[model samples]
Target: MSKQFDLSVMDGMDRREVREYVSSLLWQLRLCDGFWFLNVEKRHGRAEAEAVNGLVWDKMGDLAARDVLERFGPFADTPCGFWKAYEYLPWIPTVECAVEHDAPDAEGVIRGITVTVRRCPAQAGREKHGLEPYECREMHETEFRRFAARVSPSVQVECVQAPPDPTPPEYDCRWRFVLPVGAGGDR
Candidate 1:
């Protein structure tokens, strides 16, 4: 018979243990990504490494979106709904982030949301390793667009600021998710 393994291995853990385990996994995931890029850059070059990274993130965005909708669907096809799903993306837990939604208008229509990254673990890691900052705007734009479009075809993602761009002192990066007028409401 074939052997099967799954998260049932964690069934016996206490809540604290589970939380710790998840935190460790997130760190491992981030480190794996960082080291992978480093090795690729070493073997090939920065341009090729970044190109491959972009492709990987693009696919990850699509997969994450599909999984989010499958696991937590029936969300409104609006900006707020997209934000709800976006919050569940794995990377969110790996970094410090804050999300602010625009107050709905009199008609209860929310048009947009602002997401700010308070601290980026990747950037911190690079700084610690004495590596230059990664210029990630293009990759992030593609990733966000793919993820948001998957959630709601009309949803639009705009980058307010990201690496390679001058960011405000308080935040590392910022993004805006918006729904066009008449898509959800004209607010």
Candidate 2:
């Protein structure tokens, strides 16, 4: 995977590092997702694709959290922790790079943040493939909240917006992260 991604390609170039990284990440995601589909379909069956997607989603969240912890040190379950964790998402570079405009515009509060993906690459890719958006709404309900729960059980994930549903021209998906209604955290 590293071999195909050339850091030198971005060396003092036209300020396109983010673009390069997005391309690299997109290539990687396609490769990994393809491999997962191929093997899982052969070994298990086509019926398990959603399950496999969810499994990979969960593991990726954990791994991303680990990376953030290693780089930024531990964080308490606060709105700040949520922001820090968001930086480690594998999808970040891709989305940030691909969007025509500012992608994840974050509205921050003491105990929560609402992130809106103005343009979703996953949505575009699926459209390009003549496939409908994957069941992200269902996946995020449990898997996304579980991702945040890795930081703290109180952390909540609500799909303010997601795919397989109509979205207006302004945005593709929006996620609200906050402590449960009664959690001690502020905001």
Candidate 3:
């Protein structure tokens, strides 16, 4: 039996066209998320909006991870695997993060990696509109944890810095992913 592939609107498009379409879609996704939070904040309040936003992101993280695994996965349960899978995250392009993989130790064991958001579109948008920064520390912490757990339950996520905590001028947020000693990762 043969399977059917639904190219849908993407059918018959050239590689350049597909890239353009995907770029627009990424922008739209980011815009929609920002607008959703703003609408919720306007209707309820910052606290309520933030709470709902956190809930949504928590689920999104897990869902995104699951989707990545399903599409391109079987990534090893190690720091390297986590980083590889993380590169495919939906928000990677939209969020524009700078990920730095750490050097291996003397024993040649991969320690982990650090992700820094130097220019967060969400924060920049809020600032551009003269709004207060969203206290996203907790939300991102949960999001990262949920995402990492899906990749490997033994993977540990640590929030080095995020909103609500004073961030350095160079970056809006930074997260550290720690691989267990025996997690089996290379340089």
Task: Please tell me which predicted candidate would have the highest TM-score against the true structure.
Answer: 3
Worst 10 residues of 2 by lDDT: 97-106
Worst 10 residues of 1 by lDDT: 1-10
Residue-level lDDT tens digits of model 3 in 18-56: 999889988898889899999999999999999998999
Which has the greatest lDDT?
3
TM-score quality measure for candidate 1: 0.90
RMSD of each: 3.1, 6.3, 2.6
Winner on lDDT between 1 and 3 is: 3
Report the lDDT of model 1 for residue 150: 82
**All candidates: TM-score:** 0.90, 0.65, 0.91
lDDT of each: 0.82, 0.63, 0.84
Model 2, position 11: C-alpha lDDT score = 67
The pairs that clash in candidate 3 are none
Q: What are the clash counts of all predictions, listed in order?
A: 0, 0, 0
lDDT of 2 by residue, 17-81 (tens): 76776677777986676666657756886457667777777777777666666666566575456
Q: Identify the superior model by lDDT, candidate 1 or candidate 2.
A: 1
Clashes of 1: 0
